[model samples]
Target: MTLSQPTDAMHRKGTIISVCRIGLHDIPEVLSCGLQDFLEKPSHYFFALLIYPVIGLALFLWASQGNAWHLIYPLLAGFALLGPVAALGLYEISRRRELGLEIEWQHWFSALRSPAFPTIGMLALWLLVLFFAWLLTAEWLYLSLFGSSSAPSGPLALLADVIGTGRGWRLLILGHLIGFCFALTALGTTVVAFPLLLDQHVSLRTAVAVSLLATLKNPLPVLGWGVCVALILILGSLPALAGLIVALPVLGHTTWHLYRRLVRIDGSVAIDPKG
Candidate 1:
C-alpha cells in the first residue's frame, strides 16, 4: 500500500502498537455486537447498502457494453477488494460508539476525511490494483481457455463457452482457484486496516503490517471471520441483492469490533508496541 501521509497528529503519537491474543469465541462476540450496532441504527447502514445498487448498475452497464461478459465475474468478485473502503463510514460510527460520543450522523460523512485518510487511501489503491489485476487475469484466462480467435455473440454465448463442456469445467475450476488466491490476499491485507487507521494515527505501512501480523497471531479466528464475511456476502448477494442492505453493514460494524478485539496496543501510546 502507498500512503502519501499520516495526519499531523500522527506525529505527536500517544498510543503504542502491539498485537493482541484473540480466540474463536471472540468472533461470535464481536459479531453479536456488530449486529447490535446495526440493530440500533439500521437506517444509517441501510443507506450504506444503497451504494451496492449503484455498483451493481455500473458492473451491469460495463458488461453490457462489450462481448466480455466473462469479465463480470471478476468484477463482481473484486467488489470485495473495495469492501473496506466502502465501510469507512461504518468504522467511524463504531469509533464514535466506542468513545461514547454523541454518534452524530455527521460522523458518516466526516469519515470520508477520516484521521488516517491518506493511509487508508493508499491501502485502497493497493486493493484497486489487485482488483484490476484480477480482471486482467480473468480476461487472459477466458481468452486462453476459449481462444482469442473465437468470438461469442453475447453474454449467453460466453456463458455456454465457459459452462458447456469439459474445457469450460476446467476454466471454471482454475478461474475460481486463481480468484480465491486474490480474495484471500485481500482478506488478510485489509481485514483490520480500516478500523486500525480509524482508531489510531499509525502510518499506512504500520497499519497494514499490523493487520497481516494480527491475522498471523490469530489465524484460525481471523480466517474463520474471513470465511464468515465471505459466506454472508456471497449468500446475501442473492435474492435481488437486497440482503447486502443488512449483511454489509452488520459485517462492517462487526469488523470494527473485530479490529478492536484484535489490536490490543496502539503505537501512539507511551509504552512501545510490539512488532
Candidate 2:
C-alpha cells in the first residue's frame, strides 16, 4: 500500500484511497473467501476471537456476581463500536494471508506499529468516543424514562421492567431505536475505514471519506453487511455470549475481504453489471 507522493492526497503523506462500486452479489463472495481464509489458519483467527470470549466471560462473570444485569445490556449493544478495534488482530491475520507470508506471533501482535499508526490511533480514539457517548446516552435514557424507579434490584426485576409494563415497553423500543442509530452511524463510517487504514498508508480523513463513499455506492451490500453483523451479534448474545467466540473472527475476516472487494486502485470494481 505504499503510495507515490504527488501532493494530491490529504489523508496521508503520499497515498490515495479507493472506493469501488460493488453489488449485493459481491457480499457473499467476499464473505465466503474471508471465511475460507479464516479456516485456513484457524489458530491465528482463533486468537482473534479469543478477545471476544475474554470480554464475554468477564461481562458474564460481573453479571452473575452483581445485581446490575441491566448494565450489561448497554455494554453488549456497544460491542459493535468496539468491534472494529477488536478486529485489528484479524485484519493483521488477513493482511498476512494476502501477502503469502506465514503468521508470526511476535509480529502479528504489532497491529499498532504500522506506518499509518497515527491515523489509525486517531480513528480508534474517535470510535472509543462514540462508544462512551452511546453508553452515556443509554444511561440518560434510562434515567429520563424511569427516574429513580429505573434502577433494578435484581435480574428478575430488570427483566420485568423491560417487559412488564408500558414504561418498560417504551424503554425497550426507544433504547433499540437509539442503539440502531448509533450502530448505523458506526457502520457507515467504519465499515471499511479500519481495514483501509490497516491495509494502506492512508490518512484518517481519506479512509473515512472512502468508506462512506463505498457504502453510498454499494447500498445493497452495505445494507446486507449490516444485517449480517446484527444477526451474528444477536446469536452471539445467546448462551452467555459464547457464540461470539466463533462469530467475531469469521465476521472480522469477512470484513477485510469486503474491503478488498469494495475498493480498487482506481476507485472502481472490476465487475460486470449483468453478471
Candidate 3:
C-alpha cells in the first residue's frame, strides 16, 4: 500500500506538469491575441497620447510661477509621476488583448485592476534611478562649466566667466559620454523588465537578471535600439517638446515589441522543480 501511495503521488505530479506545459505553449497565441486587440482599439491609443499633453500643460502652468531654472525640478518630477500612467496604458493594451476585446479608453480602468500596485512600484523605482542619473549628468555639466569653484556673485560675471572658458565644448562631450554609459548599462533590462514584472508574479531579481541576459545575448540589436531612443530624445527637445506627443508613444509601443521578442514565454524548463 505504501509503494502504491508513492506511485499515485508521482502520477498526480506528472498530470500537473502536463497541464503547465499546455499553458506555457499557449503564451505565444496569447501574445498575438494581445497585439490584435491593441490594433483594433485606436481610441485607447488616442486617449493614452492625450493624457501626456494634459499633464504637460498642468506642469507648465505650475512652473510658470517660478524662475525658468526652477521649472526643471517640477518637470522632472512630473515625468517621474507619469511613468506609471504610461505603464497603465500599456497594461490596458495587454489586458484587453488577453480578453480578446477591442481597445478603448473605457478599458483604461480595467487595465488598472490587475498588477496595478506592482506596476506603479516598479515604475517609481525606475524613475528614481533616472532622476539620479539626471542629477549626476547635471553635476558633471556644472563642474565642467564653472571649473569646480565658487561662482561669481553677479549673473553677468558668471556669464562672462563661462564665456571666457572653453568649458562648454568639454561639457558637451562629458555629458554625452555619461549618458551613453548609463544607456548601455540599462539597455537590455529596461526594455522588458517592467512589463515582465507586471505580467508575472516573479520576483524583481529574476526579471532583472533575465532582462540583462537578453541584452547581453543581443548586444547589437539592443545598442541599435538605444541609439534610436537617444535620437528621439534629442529630436523631441527641438520643437518645444511637441515631438514628445509622437515620440513617446512610438518608443513605448516599440519597447513592448522588443520585450515580446526577448522574453521566453514557454515554460519548457522547470522554473522550480519542487513545484
lDDT agreement with native, every candidate: 0.76, 0.75, 0.51
Candidate 2 lDDT, 77-130, residue by residue in tens:
887788888887787777777776677555455676776778888988988999
Q: In candidate 3, what are the lDDT values of residues 1-275, reduced to their tens digit? A: 00101111112222211101112223334344444544665455665576665766666665454423323433543353234346556654654454455655665555355444565467557756765766666665665566456545454554564456577446545655765565565555555666655555445665566567666655665666666666765575456566666655555555555555555454333322111
Please identify which of the two predictions, 1 or 2, would achieve the higher lDDT against the true structure. Answer: 1
What TM-score goes with each of the models? 0.86, 0.85, 0.64
State the displacement of the C-alpha of residue 67, model 1, in Å, after optimal TM-score superposition: 2.4
Q: Quick one: how many clashes does candidate 3 have?
A: 0
> Which candidate leads the pack in TM-score?
1
Put down candidate 1 lDDT per residue, 1-275, tens digits, no spaces: 11112211112255656667677878888899898887877776566578885777688677878666777767777787788888888887777776666665666766566557787788899999999999899889888888887867787887887778888898899998998899889888888888877676568877778778787777888889978888888887776567777888888899998887776653444311110
| lDDT against true structure, model 2 | 0.75
Q: Candidate 1 clash total?
A: 11
Ranking by lDDT: 1, 2, 3
For model 1, the run of ten residues with the poorest summed lDDT: 1-10
Model 1, position 223: C-alpha lDDT score: 83
Candidate 2 Cα errors over 4 Å, as ranges = 1-16, 60-66, 266-275
